[model samples]
Target chain A: SVFNVPFTEKSSPGSTPALSDSSLQSDDEEFESVDALEIYDLISSISDPEHPLTLGQLAVVNLEDIQLDDSGNPNEIAEVIIKITPTITHCSLATLIGLGIRVRLERCLPPRYRIIIKVKEKTHQSENQVNKQLNDKERVSAACENDQLLKVISQMLSSCK
Target chain B: MSLSLVHTFTGHTDKCWATSIHSKLPLLATVSGDRTCRVYNLETKRLIVVLDDDSHSKTLSSVEWKPTGEFPSLAIGSFDSTISIWGNEEAVLEDEDNWTLMAIIEGHENEIKGVSWSHDGVYLASCSRDKSIWIWEADDNNEEFECVFVVQEHSQDVKHVTWHQHENVLASSSYDDTVKLFKQDDYDEDDWVNVADLTGHEGTVWSSDFEKKGERVTRLSSSSDDGTIRIWKILHAADDQPSIDSKLPSTIKTDTNQDMWELETILPIIHHGPIYSVAWGENGYIASVGSDGRIVVYKELNSKEWQIIISQPHSHGVYEINNIKWHGDRLITAGDDGLVKLWELAL
Candidate 1:
C-alpha cells in the first residue's frame, strides 16, 4: 500500500513519517501545479543510447503506477514506477540506458523523490541487476543530493553541446 | 504513442550492403548483393537511377560521396573487380533530369571492396581483394577519369579504403590484419606511397575510417573479424605532404612501387565483436557495428582508454555494414539483415 504525505509541514531531514489520506489534499494543489503527467513527459525526453530517438518514441520507458502520500491532506510524495527496454534483448548497453534514465529522472523530478525502475521483457542474464544498480544509485544520490552527478551531467552536456 | 514504419524500398532483391547519403543533398545511394547500385531521392521516395552490368560480376560492396558539390558525384566499388563513378552534369546543362554514368574504373583484378574520394573530389582511391590499391585523378576535361598511380603493399586482400576527412591522405585495411596509410608526395617520381602499416588485430581488418576530432588531429577507427574495434590518433604531417625517400633516385619519374610514408599507432583495442562498420558520431563518439549484429558506441578517454558507451545487438548477425550515413541528429545503418535502422543515443 502507498500513501501521499504533504510537504507543507517541514520535518527533520532524517525523520520518516506515516502516510495518510486526509492530510495530503491541503498541499496537493501546489504539487499538482507540476502535474504527474508533465513529469512523465519530461522524463520521456531521455533518448536511446544507440539510436537517434527518444525512449518514449522507442517505447523503451513504460510507466505503471503513480502513487502519492496522503498524511498531510495535500502535501503527498509522488512515487512513479517505470520499466525500461533496450534496442536488443541481449544488448550490453542496458547499463548505459539505465544510467541515462536515472540521470534524466533526476534532472526532471522534484527534490527528495523516490523513483522505482523495474526491468521487464529482458531475458539476458544480469540485466535486472544492472538496471537495479543504476536506479538505486540515482535514488540514493537524489535523496542525498550528491554533487558528483551534477558535475558529471554538466560536463556531459557541455561536451555534447 | 505508436511508431509507424516509413516507406520501404523493395527494389533490391538481395541483401543491401552499402549506403551513402549526400550530406548536402537529398540523395541516398545504396549498393546491394544483387550486384547493382541504385540511387534514390529521399524527397520523392523514388528510384532515380540504376547502374549495373556485366562489369559488376559479384556483389556491390561499398559506395561513397565525392565530398560535397552542387553537382555532387558518387563512387561505387563492387566484388566484381571494378569501381564505377556516377554523377550528374546539371551545372553545365539546362535540363538536369537524370544522373548519368560518369566513368567506369576497371583495374583491380579481384573484387574491388571499397572506394573513397578526396576532399576536393579530384581524386579517388580504391582497394580490392587483389591485394592492391589504385589512385585515380579526374581528367582536366572533368568529364573523364584515369588511373594515375597504384600501391601494391598489402600482403592480403585490401578490404576497405577511406580518405582523410580534411587532408590528402588515404587509409586502407586488409584481410592480413593490418591497416596501411597512403599519401602522395612530389619529391619522388612515384606520387603515391605507403606511409603507415598499423598491425594489431589478430583477424581480418574489414573496415577503417579517419575522423577529425580536433585541429589537424584524426581518430583512426578500424573494425576487424577478430571481434574487436580499435582506435588510433594520427598527427598529420606539418608539411602537408608525405615524406619522399631520399634513396629513391629523383630521376625515376613513375615507380608505383615506392614505399615512403610513415604512420604511428595510438590507443588500444576497444570492441568485442567482429567489427564490420565504423562511423563518426556527434560529440567525439565513434559508432561501430560488428558481425554480432551489435552497434558498439565508443568514446576516447584521455587518449588511452576508449570506453564502451553502448553495445546494442541487432536481432541477427550483421555480416557487413558498408556505410553509416549521418542525417542531422539521426544515424542510419544498413546491414546484412537487409534492414536499414536508425539510432540516436540518449544522453
Candidate 2:
C-alpha cells in the first residue's frame, strides 16, 4: 500500500531541500490543467544523467494533470502533476530528475506557479522513493526564489544544456 | 523444473543482481543488495576487488565494464537511483588499493534494472522501473561523465537494455511487452532517435542478445514472459539501405512524419512458460530459459527447420532463472534459487 501512494513529505533519500519563500505563491487547487503531452515533452528533454537517451523515449514519464487554483481567484497559481521513473527502481537518480523537473518547470512555465510532481508506481512499494524525491524537489523549488537556490538550479540546468 | 547448482559464491551476505565479465581481463564483477560490489577471479576463485567502502544503502541492480579498451573501470547501478563509475586500479596501487569513484550519475525515479557499455565503450546505457532509458557518454579520463540523452518511451517497468554488439543501435525491453531499438548518428546532440519498435509478445520481455554475423548482418533474439523465444533480423539480403518507409513508424513521432520502418519477425518458437533469459550459443543455436523450468535450445536450419536441440527442465516450476550467459563453449545459468549452473551439450 505504501508503494501505491504518490509523493510524501518524508523518506530517507538524503534530506530533500525545501523551496525558498520568494518563489512561493498561493497554493493551487488539488487538480491543475496543463497539457500532459506538452509537459512530457519538456521534462523528457532532461537526459537520464546516466544514459544517453531521453526519459520520454524510455517511457519513464508518468503524467496526471496541470491545473490552476479555483479558490478566491483562479488565475493566482498554476499547478502540474507528473510522475517520473528512474532507469532502475532503486536508482539514486530520482532526486536529480525531481530537481531537474522542478527547475525545468519553473523555467518553462509562467510565474506564480505551483507544480506537484509525484512518483507513480508500476509495482508494489515503488512510488515511495519517487514521492520522497518529489517532496525534496518541492522544498527546493519553494526555495527557488533565493538567489543562491536559483543559481544552483540554473547551474544544474545549464550543465545539461 | 529442478535447478541443479553448478556454482555458488557464498561470500556476500546480500542479494546479488548485477554481473559482467571483462573480455580481456580474467575477472567477474558482481553488485549486491548489500550495497557492495565484489570482483572475483574465476581462475583462482579469489576475491579481486571488494567495492563496498563507498556503496549504496540499498541494493545494486547492474554493473558493467566500459566497452572500450582494456581498462579497470566499472559502471554500477543501485536502488539509490544513481550510477557510480569507478576506476580505482591506479589509486589502489598508490594507497589502500581502493577503487576510486570516477563519477556518480544522479537521475531516474526508481531502481535501475540494467546498465550496459557499448561495444566501443564510448557510452553507457541504463534502464529503470520508471519505464525509461538513460544514455551517458564518457568524455575523457579526467572529466566526469555527463547525461547526453533520456528516452522515456516504455509504458511499464523497463527491465533491461542491451547494446547491439557491432552497431550504434540499442535495444530495451519492459513490462509493457514491447522492445524498442534506438540509433544515434555521430552522437551529436541529446536526441537519439527511435528507429524501430518490435512487437508480438503478449507478456513482458525479460532479456535480449544481438548475434553478430560477418560484418553487417546481425540477429536479435529475445525472451518473454509469454513463454516464447523470438528472433528478429536487422539486416536484409537486398542492399545496404532498403526502403526507408517500409519499417514501422517511430513511436515518438508526431503526425508530421509519414515515413516508417519495418522489422519482420523471423521466428517465434514457443516454450512452456515465461522466458526469462536468452543467449546465443555455438553453431547458430539460440538458447532460452523460462518459468517452465526448461532451457530450450533452438537452431535455424537452412532458414526453414527451426529445431529444438534440448528442452531440459532444469528448475522446479520454472524456478526464477534470471539470466543465462555463454562462457566459451559452456552455458552458465543463474536463477532465484541462488545457483549458477553450468551446462554442456552431450553430443
Best by DockQ: 2
Note the Cα lDDT for every prediction shown.
Answer: 0.60, 0.61
Scanning candidate 1 chain B in windows of ten residues, the lowest lDDT window is B1-10
**Any idea what lDDT model 2 has?**
0.61
The CAPRI class of candidate 2 is: incorrect
Name the lDDT of candidate 1.
Answer: 0.60
* Per-model TM-score versus the true fold: 0.58, 0.60
Model 2 root mean square deviation, Cα atoms: 17.0
What DockQ does predicted model 1 obtain?
A: 0.01
Measured by TM-score, how close is model 1 to the native structure?
0.58
For model 2, what is the error of residue B341's alpha carbon versus the real structure, in angstroms, after optimal superposition?
Answer: 3.6
